[model samples]
Target: MARMTDPTNALRLFQHAFECGQIPVERGRIDPTLMFACDEPKGRTRFNYMRAEGRTLSALVMFVHSDMIEGHPCFNIGYAVAETFRGKGLAKSTLVAGLNEFTNGLNGACIPVIHIEAVIAPENFVSQQVATVIFDSTPVTITDRESGLPALHYMRRINLPMRRL
Candidate 1:
């Protein structure tokens, strides 16, 4: 349940994941300069799930604010699981946890009508399935934002459950 505020740490995790075969090379390396672009006051947040020893990264989830969805305030979601932890459903669960944290942080103060968006490579069927299960939305074909490749987009509205005050 560690939050990664430093771009370097997050990039390290990403590189590790890539080296361990979690991320395919075709996705291309993330530009160092852009890593902190979303680290603004109200732009992006990253969640890191580590193994029990707290040394190995099990999964990573990030939500970045985006205006690509038209009318709906959206946070584009991205995530990855370590190779050793893959196929165990770690990615989906971690993403759920990340979303809960993000929504809860709103604190009902100015609850914006927002939605979560997952842009996945069309060839990566596994992630597409995960996003469908979590978001319950049919994916629409679109060009990948970063790669300029074909992608599938999944989205669903999010709300902060009212607390019993």
Candidate 2:
């Protein structure tokens, strides 16, 4: 698992996906190098390999590149699942794992992440559909005045430090 974080490994997988046209890199998006360069001080970036049946289904990234919101950091969940594994619930479930880590202590108490975001393009219907199920509320369209991008913004929040009656 530790080796997956290696820059070379990430580059290999990223290159494969890029060559297959599964991701948009030339359109000013992501570069494989970014996966290795996610460091501290400003924000955090992490790229995890999604494995199924001991085989890699996707390379998912959950990055807290932005500062915290209401004391909770906002990390964006981005993934590039292999084309062959598309239409299956792998991506949807992968998203659930991220949301769960924030809500529940699925990843343990040390990393009590609570808020996450997923910004999707208007035309990406597959992701739009997944976002609908992942978030409790409907996806919000960010207008030019409201935000920088015109993508659909989806967020999940869980108030931590629960009280007992």
Candidate 3:
């Protein structure tokens, strides 16, 4: 379960998942965007990890740096688990693992506080439920980000003590 930063490994992992048809097409289509996003010259970082067993990728999670509410440092997590591994909570496990790695790796260098935020479409009840379970009573809100449509914002503090780098 190593977090992959090498472009080659990332691309290979993505291609394998796509070829298997185990990933939702809509979400899997972001592979190209992720490639571009991670290659940007800016300081923003995108961390990706693959769950593997004997050289085969079973699942992956991508954490992209983003602002939660203009001033808050947060990570937007996107994940996909292989069809053969969906119901066993791999998504949740991967998420937690990514969070821990991100917090430890970036806590002192990035913003002073670490928060995880998920912006889910209002009608995506399953995503909302997942966030609720992961965040455990953290504040949730509905926001309209100039799209004229409401979206759900779920937030959780990572409890990392942060200091300016």
Candidate 4:
């Protein structure tokens, strides 16, 4: 999977994903406002914040350092796999790679902890199963106050001890 480091490239990927309908426009999946949230700025700030990675735009993820339920700066991952790429393990692999990259702390200093959350529709059993395996557990159902959509929140955390080398 290729990790996108350049802002221009990231925006291009986002636009491509949107045009391909990998993300639902009605759900505000790729809405400009949501894409440029305060939690994640626009342009390079957002692009730099999310370690974007994928293969040929078929699958990709946008990850960020955010305060998870544990109140720590853990990686929060959001992804979209093109319809053709589904059931091919690309999503799972991409997510795993992204997690590993951040866990290893490519920049410097191990993050010490990592967390991923997936918000899925209750009827999206396929995605639920995928998340179950990646997260190693069933997701908890939650009411999304903002959209009022019934969503399943899947989460996982990793913590390890090691000397800074």
TM-score for each candidate, following the candidate numbering: 0.66, 0.58, 0.59, 0.60
Q: Considering every candidate listed, which one attains the maximal TM-score?
A: 1
Model 2 stretches astray by more than 4 angstroms: 1-43, 47-49, 59-65, 101-113, 143-149, 161-165
On a 0 to 1 TM-score scale, where does candidate 4 land against the true structure? 0.60
For residues 43-139, what per-residue lDDT tens digits would candidate 4 score against the true structure? 3222111222332345555566545555545544566566555678766665555555445443344555556666776876766665765688777
TM-score sort, best first? 1, 4, 3, 2
Between the candidate structures 1 and 3, which one is better when assessed by lDDT? 1
Count clashes in each candidate, considering only residues at least 3 apart in sequence or on different chains.
0, 0, 0, 0
lDDT of 2 by residue, 1-165 (tens): 111121234435655665575643221122222222233434355534333332233434344444488776666656545566667776676555544443443244444456767777677788778777667777788742324446777887755565344
In the order shown, the candidates' Cα RMSDs to the true structure are: 10.7, 10.9, 10.2, 10.9
TM-score of 2: 0.58
Collision pairs in model 3: none
* Global lDDT of each candidate: 0.59, 0.52, 0.57, 0.52
The positional error of residue 158 in candidate 4, measured at the CA in angstroms, is 0.9
lDDT of 1 by residue, 38-64 (tens): 243353453332221133556666677
Candidate 1 regions exceeding 4 Å error are 1-53, 68-72, 161-165
Predicted structure 4: lDDT: 0.52
lDDT of 3 by residue, 7-118 (tens): 3355465657556755442211222212111322267676665565433556666777777655676776656666666678766676666555556656577466666766
The pairs that clash in candidate 1 are none
Residue 134 accuracy (lDDT) in model 2? 66
